[model samples]
Target chain A: MAGSHSLLDLTAHALAEEIEAGEVSAREAAEVANTRIGEVEDEINAFVTTTPGLALERAEAVDARNGGRNLWEGVPLVVKDVLSTRGVRTTCGSRILENFEPLYDASALRNFGDDLIVVGKANCDEFAMGSSTENSAYGPTRNPWDLGRVPGGSSGGSAAAVAAGEGWWALGTDTGGSVRQPAALCGIVGLKPTYGRVSRHGLIAFASSLDVVGPMTRDVRDGALLLQAIAGHDPRDSTSANVEVPDYLTNLEDGVEGLRIGVVPELMGEGIEPGVREVAERVASGLEGAGAEVGEASLPHSGYGLPAYYIIAPAEVSSNLARFDGVRYGLRVSADGVHEMYRKTREEGFGAEAKRRIMLGAYALSSGYYDAYYAQAQKVRTRIIEDFQAAFARYDVLLSPTAPTVAFEIGEKVDDPLAMYANDICAVPANLAGIPAISVPGGLSEGLPVGVQLMSDHFTEPTLLRAARATEQVADFRYQMKP
Target chain B: MISEEQVRHVANLARLGLTDDEIEKIGGQLDAILDSIEKIRELDLADVPPTANPLDLSNVLRPDGPRPELSQEEALFQAPERVEDLFAVPRID
Candidate 1:
């Protein structure tokens, strides 16, 4: 345990290699991660619950196993609370399921196959509804770089944990911009694979059509490794793609020469912060200098992505969340009758944003308004997809700022829902289009990190990861959290 | 702008009991958000087909076969209230 503290500095890949080579024991790596979590948990509030006993038990098993053939053998990971882990309390950052323990593990977690040690469950927005972790019923997760700022959400805790070195890597689900936006703010790498590319068997639904299980890691290579472990088909999930899983690390070093990178002009203009825009410009020039052909590509419907997302996401949310009624599991408030029990249970269980969204979604899907709101949003979503397809016809990949601005003060946008929702504008297009996209540390602006986003056609993660790795090298922006 | 009455109606439809203050607050907030999203109404999308699933997957049928299922004990493990082998809920009318 003496030299274990330094293990926090190594990426998940490096840590796994060290453990496999007998340079470090799996328990030692877990101890290092748990120690780091203990040091930073009070400040960042990254995890809702830590399973040190389970982690140690798994680590010992890893040490006892034959050979380290699994890529994630002995690696420490943190799973976002949104994913189900059998017997572990998965809160989804809500009081409704405060003590609810799942009976089955998510397919993604099971895919790791007893090798990766899960240190804890990362906190997130209530049912993954909000742009800031402030919507989390437990509390907000603070940015590792500046405790006063938020680690963007609804995957805020996962991003903050990886940024603070609490875990080597963390699993996060992105619906809208949950993973990439937070990773951008926390100065790490987050990749949302193409929809259906990753199984969603145990990921609690937000917007079912848009939700994707993604990885948040300290570096691009680590992100690729984690994605490789979790990406594939699952019989339990009907929507899971049957596509063959590729070796993500194989083509990762293939540089971006002759790759046509498109910069969406609409995302670069008005409402984007000047400093963040400058970082994006620098990333474009960096890619150009590295021999990638970077030029402006327009997505005319990009401006409508955020609006369409709000309508579409909330509509699905209302339907998905109806399962939380007091009849089955989770929190139940007693009343004189079943109807009153259902009403009172939800009233006491859900947080403010959750109630707001449920109401909005109900209204959108109501008899007369459905055509005006829900249908219209779906049509706009189609337009957004078509826009991306048109752009991709001319370019191999698309580029943009991950968010409109850097991390903001924790309480700054909490009161204003519109302001909080604006944080996801630059990242939602990819989710809407069902394409793979990544957020890599572009640079720092006003002392906070800015993310340069790279998006590619569906199922082209090899190209996307390769281009992102190239950008990662060129930017060379190291993640450093002040003690 | 959405009225407090409309907000209460929607909350009722969603089966959520809301306080007066919550109804008023959410009403104003929803109005502003809806106004911002109203820009989507400007486009002439008459001929465009709505896309519910971007992947365009169809007939995703799994073979009908017996597979492992959660035992009764495991299924009832997390239930807030359970009666023998079934989940217990408050009585209706």
Candidate 2:
């Protein structure tokens, strides 16, 4: 494990305090964190690449420039592999780009570099596809809580690193619950900022419209702090929204009293595990105890989110991933002819799930089927967005269980495609509608963590953070898990 | 009839090379997938304008301004193999 006094040992907020006080140098903390990863990372497979030497150098520079102007300095963190990091091997958890190194730092990573040390790139689901890190071409990232189970995925390794105290906090991409679901499973806090609230310039495209980069941390305050640093407009990313960036940490003390919190009736009522339902009830009671007006809210279109996402995501996948053609980038295979070369390259480069998505997507957006599948899915996407907007009109944020269940055994759903897709049933709507959502640890179920998700309309992260802080203060669960 | 030839065309478009046996396997899978997609053809929308932005951000335009450029070394570093200021890859021609 990482040293007890490493940067990973102190919370981002606490580490800043120590750094400002000159109690520890940034380089010393980076070295301690590096030593810890050397001990436990092999067993957990949480990192794809570790750059301790570069991390220490960066730490030294941050220490030298310690004008104490930046709110956070001397904090170490991990960058999700999905975001491009200059000079680092950013594989996106696929063999196709296993050797690919980014030429430029993603704007978000650049911002992170200003105050935090990038310890390494965390492992993830291959192309961010599967619910479990089992989909990674390198290997599955074992849950820190239970080595036998999954850490929930795409951003599984990011969540695992924070859960295991590998880093103070980490950046993770949430496309269809990649960040929130894993954070839920690992008993941490993860936020999926409003679709365009955080720039996507550096992150690899999964479902471009749905993908968001956000913070994964041990506490809600750390999550809010990290969000403040990375949430803003970037000219490089066309999808990035021009919105006011709020001081998330400052406004977090605002209590949820008199705030309208909606409990999604469908999520609480059925198909949810008894344990999850119990936690949801507890969360509502907790909100009510905090002086928030809690009531049931219905979103009927939520039922169709998964089906629509499956169709829409792949259709976009078919087009977005087309750029991976061997000629421009990624693995290229030699064949009898040019056409055969292209054919062989993709077939061999992509994993089974990737292939499945590409084919499904191509068929959905094909000439004859476009109107029926892609077109209809778009309309459904519109309705889902409308449903959330109508609900936000009635409530400050919508509350539900992030996932239907807690972390399941690794390899349990690897072979079942439909069951794997169903995992994102509740989380997909927030993505489709371009809104902010966060998953905070609610309680434990069968020795695993259950998550309570808070979702709000676009650019409502301030309100969401306010609600999250209140929950953190009053939730019956403890932050530290029993070993 | 969507033949193996048509399958090869699409596969080539997607940059996947399939062996003879794999081609046959994927061809069958594509046929089934395509048959299912044929259901979309039944929808008749005479007047619905094709939509892109569901959230209605119609005037989403960025101010045309200069941005920093990636150094040549950084840009070239992303290539799997580069030589003499050019990305090195097997010649398609």
Candidate 3:
């Protein structure tokens, strides 16, 4: 207990060893995390629900396991509220599901290895609708670095919690840059594996086709470890890839010596902040210095990503979200007729951002407009995929700034939906293309973290991790340095 | 640009009843966003096939068999309105 603060700095892999070796009890780790959360929860509302008591109880369960083969047996994990945890209040950051406690854990979270220290359910944008956590039914999660600034979201709380040492790592879903953007903004490692890389069985659907549950950790190595724990096939999720699960740890430290690394010129173009561009370009130089061939990579249709996503993603959203009616779980407002009840429930339950998206989706998929909007976006999606497939044929991995800019002020782009959507300009292409992409901490720009995003072809996580690990070494940004 | 009536009609179609104030405010924002989304039409997509699934997967069939499913009790645990063993709903008028 005397030197417990330093224990918080250990990665999940290292922390598990400590717990296994009897160096630190699981209970002590939970207590330490709770203490940290208590100290800093005021400035950063990272978690919508904190399970201090449950964490202690779960940690004791892990302690009883007495060091099995699990790598994260006793690690504290911040779960984004969108991923259903059995019996825990899983809000998806929407008031509609404010009191909704799931009866089961997400397939990705099913293998808890006895049990994990459930730090809390991290806050996010309502139904994962917005780019910032400001749209959370619960108030916004402020950036720990500067309380006035935003932690790029809808995974803002998860990123903030990990950065603030509230949780060792977190689970964030990336529909269109939710996980990676927040991770980059919070100066952590975020990985969005290929579309079907991770199971989406229990992840509350925002955009079924695009939603991918990903790992958000303090460093590249930990990100690899976290992804290993959750990445696998689930029969329940029809789209879940039945591919061979590789040992992410094996080729991780293997340098990107002879790998072809491409810096996407389009992502680093005009609208992107100059400071962010400098940092991203420096990452390419750093990787080049580390023995990798670095050059410009062009994804010709990349600029169409935002428009395509707004159409495609929202179309999926309207259909997937139709299940949240008052008839079942979550909020229900009583009315004379069943139709009136459904309408009123959604109107009252959803936040403004959610409503806007549902409207956009409904409008796009409407009778006559579906062909022009939805169908056109789908064709654009094919074009985007073709663009990436061509680039990947020549390059082993592609790099870009994770976000166009560093963490901006909280209220900066809230009113401007277009400006908010622009934050993911660089990230949307990866989702659209169905490829694996990562946001690794690439030092700081304007005194805040800038992320060097590495993307690779489908199911090539090993190669992706190799490039990320190499970048991690070159960046040499202190992961333990907290806000 | 979308008219307010269209916005209302879409909202109704989506099963969401919005107030006049919300409809007016959200309508203005939706117009701007749609304008940006309209830019997707600039590309010539006549010959290109649309990608409904990113992986281009279709009709993944499993052999006919009994599959594991949530028990009735488990499924209805979170139901807002339940009577006896069934999910309760008001009669449609």
Most accurate candidate by DockQ: 1
User: Which residue pairs does candidate 1 place in steric collision?
Assistant: none
Error of 1 at B80 (Å): 1.5
Docking class of 1: high
The DockQ of predicted model 3 stands at 0.84
lDDT of 1 by residue, A1-483 (tens): 225447766888998788878899889888888887888799999999999888988888888884845858679789999999977899999999998898778898776674557899998999988777888888899998999999999999999999888888899999998999999999999999999999999898889999999999988999999998899999888889999999899999989899999999999999999999999999999999999998899999989999999998999999999889877788999998888998999999999999888988899999889988889989998999989889999999999999999999989989899999999999898988899999999999998899999999999999999999999988849866434
DockQ for each model: 0.85, 0.31, 0.84
lDDT by residue (A138-158, candidate 3, tens digit) is: 999999888899998999999
lDDT per residue (tens digit) for residues A1-483 in model 2: 434643655677888678778897778878877887787888788899998988898899898887844656578878889888877889888888877877667787666564447899999988888788888888899888899899998799999888877777899998889999999989999999988888889788888867889999888888888888788888788778887887887778889989999999877766688998788789889889889999877897787677777877877777777777566467777655556666667777777777767766876676776777788767777777777878988999899999998888998988667767767877888888878889989888888899999998778788899999887776666566212
Question: Which 10 residues in a row give candidate 1 chain A its minimum summed lDDT?
Answer: A1-10
Question: Candidate 3, which CAPRI tier?
Answer: high
Which of 1 and 3 is the better model by DockQ? 1
Query: What TM-score number comes out for model 1?
Result: 0.98
Could you tell me the TM-score of chain B in model 1? 0.94
After superposition, candidate 3 runs with Cα above 4 Å error: A1-5
Q: Docking category for candidate 2?
A: acceptable
True contacts kept of 1: 0.86
